[model samples]
Target: MLKPNTLALTVVLALLTALGPLSTDMYLPALPAIAQDLTASAAQTQLTLSLFLFGFAAGQFFYGPISDRVGRKPVLLFGLALFTLASLGCTLAPNIESLIAARFLQALGASGPIVIGRAIVRDLYEGARAGKELSRMASIMGVVPAIAPVLGGLIAPWGGWRMNFVAALLFGAGLATVVALRLPESLARKSAQTLSFLSILRSFRSLLGHRGYRVYVMLSLLAYGGLFAFISGSSFVLQTVYGLGPMAFALSFSFVVVGYIGGTFLAQRLVGPHGLDGTIRIGVACLALGGSLMVVLVASGVASFLAVVGPMALYCMGVGLTMPQAMASALMPFPDRAGTASSLLGICQMSFAAILGIVLGQNLDGSALPLPLTIAATGLMALAVFGLTGRARRG
Candidate 1:
């Protein structure tokens, strides 16, 4: 029996959180079109995507502490404004270089809502309850990735890629209006901390020094690396290696989303009873199982699309399970510094994923070996780190 206001707030926060994935996935169908229209190489057009991630990671480091000092509402509104302007810039870019720059700026603007959105959640809840709320939000946010590409595919042909940016612009503006009108300030007590560079550095150092926080953050980074590997390589793997058309590839990608939705639902149900740590263990087990199965399938010469999609879907479910718990756990000890904590978490996840995306992109051959293998390796690393850290803490 959730309150109506609570439910509405969660929905709004979920939408805010979904913006990054929507911005990334929505224009994927237009990559080749963007390249051809701008007279750019495939790699150059791809930079538009990677740079957005880098900007996102970099922007979070700034927004988190600022929000902690100034409150969430102002920061969110500012971000939405920046995001809208950047979206327009993206829509009107004259060339690939301009588009890349606009995309980076767009991500910088988008980072505000994402980092602050999580901080808002931390402001309202804690411990296993926070994990449940996050899982619920994840359930709603999961649909964005599932549908963004399909919408992009439909829209890209109508106006040649720029239409996707227009859609994003409208979305940002609408969301901004919603926030300005209805969203209440969740940061009831703004930190008295200064926004000085040295102060920010000290806060970051303190959080990083916490062994539990470090372990959870590292686990999240590894999980995100695996997820981004899927994102960076999936289009090429499906379209080039498996011969899926644009629409077909988008549909296959939805399998991962479906798995995510299911996993979030499971996490929401289980976290209250099992606790966050137990839920995380279940998630890591799922991740390892899925990743291992995918590697074995690909290694044994089974090249069917279902073979790849099925196991990846399982892996995504694991991601869905792991992230909410990990995020809640990571920020639980930093109630006063939730904004900064959320920011660091976003930076670690996005930076690692961006680096992994570059690595995967560079190593692409005509085979699917690299993607699944990378995913499996990341899963194993996360599990190993989590286990070792837990044992050390107990010892």
Candidate 2:
């Protein structure tokens, strides 16, 4: 059943998943120093990360749909080329504004694999295999992001923060070369007149009509929003307010990610027996518990910056637990529109987080408490939406 190709495909998909993390993590350790050098506020520097995510979210819409029409490899190469060039721009950027603008373009290019690769996997496998494959790829990201900040912290001072972008540029080029040489064209030759925008508009309507799809997308958007906000502000909370150095922070930061890894591993086992509904319930419950702890810490005036260590990990675990089920359900009905479907999901996810990130970044207040409280509030909001979506479907 498990062929070598299946394993190879998993590895490739893992590399694709690596793109987002590679973009985010490598620069994390340098945020504080960059802020000082750029003479910008913590919030302003954070905007650079948030803005890149904004581009990452928006880019998915164009690339995903186009890949459906033209096939995966060519579209992938095109995005990678743009990403590589953008990375060069980032490296050579003369100021904070220039770096931020180039980061947006770089994220636009990097988003190619993240948005399209999910659909490509669907093109190759379906049903339970699809969910399993997705989890396998997510596992790589879970592990990689956990360690990336640590690595970034270690290298950033020695190499300069900009070197991180150069590393990302090189990594993208290397991955593109591997894909160019090794990847087969996976899209089946479909000669059907590619659905027009108006027709795809109807497909969107039909997609919303499906109860499972609506629930899944909304849940993923809410869930991922919380994580993005945390990432957006962790530098300020940990390194600046709490006076942590890069290495200490990365090591402490990863402890939270451990919760996510545990939850996803558990979800993989539980999904088969408990079903999507049950797995999501457990994930949300854990998330709610984590969120409540955050609010409690802040309200009680007992908040140490370290209070984040426990809750953030739990929150990320909930995301890992819920992602496979939500992803599987969203993709289940649209084998034909896998690209379109994934693009839609990507749109909701990034848009949701972008709004939340903008709000959180705007409120940094020179204290660590706001960061955790913002994360807690977003987590609470996500749990509420997750519950409502589930109830709406049942009624």
By lDDT, the best candidate is 1
Poorly placed runs, candidate 1 (over 4 Å)? 1-5, 391-395
Query: Model 2 over residues 143-229: C-alpha lDDT tens digits?
Result: 877887887887787888888888888888998888888887777854254657776566567778888788888888877777887
Q: Per-residue CA lDDT of candidate 1, range 152-219, in tens?
A: 88898788799999999999999999999998888879999879879988999999998888888987
Model 1 score (lDDT): 0.87
Q: Give candidate 2's error at residue 63 in angstroms.
A: 1.2
With candidate 1 superimposed using the best TM-score fit, by how many Å does residue 373's alpha carbon deviate from the native?
Answer: 1.6
Quote the positional error of residue 350 for candidate 1 in Å: 0.7
True lDDT of residue 228, candidate 2: 81
- Regions more than 4 Å wrong, model 2: 1-5, 189-206, 391-395
Summing lDDT over every window of 10 consecutive residues in candidate 2, give the lowest-scoring window: 1-10
Note the residue pairs that clash in candidate 2: 256-313, 260-317
TM-score of the candidate numbered 1?
0.96
